[model samples]
Target: MSNLTRTQEKELKEAFDIFDRDHSGSISARELKAVFKNLEISASDQDIKNAMKQMDINNDGEISFSEFSRVMEAQFYRKYTHEEIRAAFDHFDKDKSGYISADELRMTLSKMGKTFRKDEVDKMIKSIDKDGDGRISINEFMDLLN
Candidate 1:
């Protein structure tokens, strides 16, 4: 959380608030499950239990914003090798171009069994496409994944 920019922290806070549906300050397992359902993320009972167990650092059967943000920061510091990251970017950059176009992103996701509409694909690209390039540069892609 300390390393996150203000905007990033704000976004995380918003996500946490989404899970904290009861205005309860903390997110109970039931609240998290409802949020997951609302997002159409098909998390299983075991998945929810495991997630709750992992994030409830205080063993309180709930996740505080601190706990949730800590887990998010841990994920931000993921352990992928540099080569692995490059390979992933390459996989998405289908034409071997230096940047990833919206079509390439959509096709790559589709090939990997992910189905996103055109607007969805565009939105994903827009989020990572810094410099108003309308495409994802390798640096931007690396910044996002690594």
Candidate 2:
């Protein structure tokens, strides 16, 4: 029932193999922590624990190949429904306009305590505004999200 393509499934299997250092067909918490560290991915001990708990669906202390495949497939290939994307866009469009202005983006980010340089914001807007419009429409936002 996964949306992942054959290529994606193969890649996920390869990655899982790499993480399963012991070839035990499962990855332990210590192995997961080492993999994160080796990849320079910043994750706290608690974060790793939580991730294991979520991925280890069988309540096992380790993540089996099937579990890893399922989790990776969901994480990488799952797409949000149009209504969910629209609802999120509506939340940001404070003026009830169909587009999100750079000002609105700045305000939202500011509210979130995330400050970015003016150039950075402009770059972000330019990147997301696929139609070269000055603002991001719901369609554009959804495209960016996907």
Off by over 4 Å in 2: 78-146
Per-candidate RMSD, Å: 6.9, 9.8
Per-residue lDDT over 1-146 for candidate 1, one digit per residue giving the tens place of the 0 to 100 score: 28988887897887787677787999999988876675446899999999999999999999999999999876555777779888778867779988999998887655433568999999988889889889998889878876
Off by over 4 Å in 1: 79-146
Local accuracy of candidate 2 as per-residue lDDT tens digits, 8-112: 788688778778877899999988987777544579999999999989999979999889988888757568889988877886788988999888888765543
Relative to the true structure, candidate 1 has a C-alpha RMSD (angstroms) of: 6.9
Clashes of 2: 0
